[model samples]
Target: MTQSGFDTDRPVRLGVQLAPQHHDSYQVIRDAVSRLEDMGVDILFNWDHFFPLSGDPDGTHFEGWSMLAAWAEQTERVEFAALVNCNSYRNADLQADMARTIDHISKKGGETGRFIFGTGSGWFERDYTEYGYEFGTAGQRLDALAEALPRIESRWAQLNPEPTRDIPILIGGAGEQKTLRLVARHADIWHSFVSPDELPHKLEVLSRWADKEQRDTSTLVLSNELGRRDEAEARKLHDAGVRLFTHGVSGPDIDFDSVQRWLDWRDGING
Candidate 1:
């Protein structure tokens, strides 16, 4: 494990968010999934949204949880989840049940499962408008998320056969006051969007939050986007305590050439 400035001695792990949008066919996504797991990537992710976020507003898109269930049966190793599930879209207890079912399906024969519950307070208003959910204030949404997480955990515990393993809660976002505090209290993994330079400060804030929440920051895995970052920036982030680096890819026909560089970089660090 690489020694970051923080108390994290975790191994470097590579992840990719395969955007489930703009795909003309689902077969393209299936092939990409096979390739990513074969490439020895550590995690797989897809976003939770009703429409495309890039290219075309009306482009073809697939639902997140549905694909996640398929991934549960399809892949054998890599952990998978929505890049960040919108808590506003579904009932908290229902989300817990859905995740548990997927957890059960992901197991081959062992007692463990590879489902990461990556979620966030939603930001896309069109999804709310079309889906008939109220487009509430950001604070309200975050509050809802805060309220829902406990219910989800309670539901997990009450389920017939509890989740194969503690489904890792990966909370994504970097807002100092609310999001980071939630991450400190609940998240097993904290995925950040801030740049390398800003990471130290954000982490400092998170540390403070952890202290306040009576949680140890060392128990949380730090994640960051690997797409726009150069190797130097990535190393900088790594030094700051980030262990899980994620790059995102979109598809009709997805390519792996760009991703190969990240894989090699990850191997170089973890090898």
Candidate 2:
């Protein structure tokens, strides 16, 4: 269970993307948040989209930011965020305002808040078309995202009391030209959907960009979504320098066993 390139001394962090598109989303998310936090998960995330990515195309999906506010109120120990919020869905300043509000909610008690502002360029064409947003080309969307990042960060500062803390930005995507560059400039955490074999090259590219920018690449956390349920494979990923792991499952019957296995792996790695 030894993780290569990772500091075994540092506590391993496990995260889950609670699909908000299935069953009674409001209640399911509430219950899952409580259960996962109690089960010792480090982070909980929900996807930001209007329609279900899986299951019925027009399933019972819920809005991301509102659900997050509820999670901030309900959970105490686990950090919460959207796996990657769609920047095209909301205005940049407004997105920052929503995050700041959630940060305040999570920190209502004596303890500090835990909300990572994970976001990216919008991709689901259905979401944009149905919601009246202009479904621009991929390049155009990336351009918008690049412009929005700074405004989102700046607005967080202008908000009263600032944020509960420095809200960590987690950008999702592995596109070499746009996504990796954006990650180097803005993200505290970079999430890629590819397998481990593809990761080393991307990491190297990011490192090169970081070097050019005079930024400390080590501070940017490398994260990836596990595609299969093999602990050995997950371990291999850990050995290759991916510290944060995420997996997706549809709702109604969430594969809790899958979640437990990941949690167990995280615990064993840290121990």
Candidate 3:
């Protein structure tokens, strides 16, 4: 493991979150996934929500897990998952089984599956309200997530045909108290939206939590968003210990201009 907690030998990876909103047809989204994989993106992600996150609230949208299942059959190389599934949407055991099933679906040519289980406590009140789930307090939701993670792991163990591989668990959010502690305890990757300036402090806190939990967090991968950051900014983030960078692209018409720049940057770094 590197000093930053990620395996030093592993090259920097690029991920794109194709927000499953504002698209008129699944074919268009499916084409986009193929384009991304062809472009050599290491990971592909979609958000978990019932409605659009941007533009009109009731715009055209597709559910994340279903889309992921399609992606499993659609692409051969890209690792994919919900950017973060809402823990409150389904039972923990069910979620584990679904993840395992998708993991198997993604396998090809004697290769292990390429599925990552990225999840967190549900936060979008609109999803809960419209979907008929109680929009409980944030703390309450986090507590539920804390309780469910272990059960998810246990269920994975009990499944008849286990996951093709130890499906990586990526916990998203930057809540210093509950979220980070949970990340330390259960996550293989910790995704945060914190800005580059704030990352050092947050990582310090994560390290402290790992020490308290007695886990060797040096193997944990740090993830962050690409947004509008340029190469210099990305380098700073890399220097600060982040190796996995994801950029969100929304649709109607999807753009790959920025994604290409980031991919080029990643290639330069890896080379």
Runs in model 2 with CA error above 4 Å?
1-9, 108-111
What C-alpha lDDT do the candidate models reach, one value each?
A: 0.90, 0.83, 0.90
In the range 33-110, model 3's lDDT, one tens digit per residue, is 999999999999998999998899889999999999999988898999899999999999999999999999999975
Worst 10 residues of 1 by lDDT: 1-10
TM-score of each: 0.97, 0.94, 0.97
Q: Per-residue alpha-carbon lDDT of model 1 for 127-203, expressed as tens digits?
A: 99999999889999999999999999999999998999989999999999899999989999999888877887797
> Which stretches of candidate 1 lie above 4 Å from their native place?
1-7
Which residue window of length 10 is worst by lDDT in model 2? Answer: 1-10
For candidate 3, the C-alpha RMSD (Å) to the true structure equals: 1.5
Root-mean-square deviation of candidate 2:
2.1
TM-score: model 2 vs. ground truth: 0.94
| Count of clashes in candidate 2 | 0
Per candidate, the number of residue pairs that clash is 0, 0, 1
